[model samples]
Target: MLTVQDHELVAAAIGEAETRTDGEISVVVAPESDSYADAVLHWALLVALLPLALFATFPDLLHWATAFVHEPWGDEAPPLRLIVLFLLFKTISAFLVAWAIFRLPRVRIAITPHETRTRRCRRRAIMVFQVGTERRTATRSGVLLYLSMAERHAEIVADELIQSKIGGEEWGEAMAALLAGIRAGQPGQGIADAVRLIGDVLATHFPYTGTDPNEMPDRLIQL
Candidate 1:
């Protein structure tokens, strides 16, 4: 959810970063890393089970409660229709509540495990690198800086060339910086700063040669 000005600032940051190194850097921001449907379903199922358990475990109690309310008509065991109606009402109410809760973005995200979110972000980042950034240039020196808004996660993926020169963990600082920005509610500034940091690293290992060609697009990708 970046503004036009934020997009322009990010583009400029990428351009400025590329000026110092042959390594091509790309930034991608996604609304979410994954659909998290599994997590939502898990929560929904738990909620739905509550109604089933209550009906199954306390049938006698429920019947008594219903009979108590209908005492004016003479105390009788709850009718089959009444029991079925109560069960259905409870079941439907539980599901409806679950649906509403899961519809909240934060609630769905909270239901997802941290490890799952991290893995999804990393996998998505790698995919973006392979399909969008990798091997596009002469030296195969491409890096992707990716952010997942919902997960509040950031990842760095470098092509074979860059990986050969620097270990993946070397980009930890940049990733941390990006995540910090996100945690602080300043994603744009965080990404911009991370780009600058990554630029510095690339420049150190792959100085811009006069023959370096701009083989990849410089603008930030929004997905």
Candidate 2:
């Protein structure tokens, strides 16, 4: 979703933002937050069992199908073994078809529950914050801006010092600006705008001192 020029733009924005605040800022973008293989399996299994449920609820449907395969001159119903085998074949075929279709990234993401995507994206952003930005600054003023493209989700994680000083709602404007950029298909611009807003907030509470050192890389991290 980002090109070389976009990457450079985001990196430059972060650098510019940090120059005005003691807080450190980092941006991370991901193609997706999770593989969702389990979700795919669940959907495929449901599809495979649908026919069984239908036949169980309405046995007449099964009988109607069996009659088509039975000889018209024969008085006997279709063999039970044949019926079982046919059902097994159909169930397996349905499962394979569903599995194949859901394996695609776009299809899987489209069918995934909104709550699931939001939860996964949040979890990933937290993890990234913990590993890379949390407590890495001298004053615990590190911030991470994370974006998950497939889910169309964004998150901002602040270190202990920033969190103690800033309310979560204080970042609403920054979040809104970021999301607007994303919805407009300009992720780079969205991220840069968010960084600028975040920088203004940080500058208000933690204005840069001449002696403050650059504690983090300014480049945008892509995953």
Candidate 3:
């Protein structure tokens, strides 16, 4: 969610960064990497099983419920079919209620494991790099800087040539700077700072040659 001015600043940063290196750089920002609907369904299933678990743990509870359903004049307990239907109703209700609550964006994100979000964000970034940035440059030095707002995660995906020369740990400073800006509620600024740092790294390994062509767009992509 960047403003017009922020967009301009990021585009300028990309342009300035490219001036020093032949490497291609692309910036992509997304609201979220995944919907995580499967996680919500899993939680709902657990809630639905609670009734069955309680019934199994305390057989007397089921007996009491059956007795309550019987007629006052007749001392006989409810039929097996009636008891089964009641249990099914209770389980379904629990599942429906839990699903409604957990489907909320804030609640869903809070309950989701951080590791899951990170993994999904990384996977999405890699896919994006492959589709748009990978092997696009003459020297195959393209890099994709991706940020997921909902997960609060950032990823740096580089093409074959860049990855061969640069280790994952080498991007620590750029990642830290980008995350710090996000934590401070300035995603646009954070991305630009990361871009500059990345540019420095690329420039060191692949200096801009007069014959190098601009193979990628300089604008920031929002998704």
TM-score of each: 0.88, 0.93, 0.92
**Superior candidate under TM-score, 1 versus 3:** 3
TM-score (C-alpha, index-matched) for candidate 1: 0.88
Write model 1 residue lDDT over 1-223, tens digit each, in one string: 6878778888888999999999999999999888888888878878988977875798777877657556666635457766677667777888878978996999888888899999988999888878898888888898899888888888888888888899877787887888787788777878988998899999999999969889888888999
> What is each predicted model's overall lDDT from 0 to 1?
0.85, 0.91, 0.90
Give lDDT tens digits, candidate 2, residues 103-181: 8999999889999999999999999999999989888989999999988899999998899999999889899999999
Better lDDT candidate (1, 2): 2
Measured on C-alpha atoms, candidate 2 has an lDDT of 0.91
Best by lDDT: 2
Off by over 4 Å in 1: 65-85
Q: How well does candidate 3 score on lDDT at residue 43? A: 94
The TM-score-based order of candidates, best leading, equals: 2, 3, 1
Candidate 3 lDDT, tens digit per residue, 79-186? Answer: 787788879999999999999999998888877888898899999999999999998888889999999888888999999888889999989999999999888988
Least well predicted 10-residue stretch by lDDT in candidate 3: 69-78
Q: Residue 113 of model 1: what lDDT?
A: 89
Models, CA RMSD each: 2.6, 2.3, 2.1
- Deviation in Å, model 1, residue 68 alpha carbon: 6.3
**Local lDDT at 175 for model 3:** 97
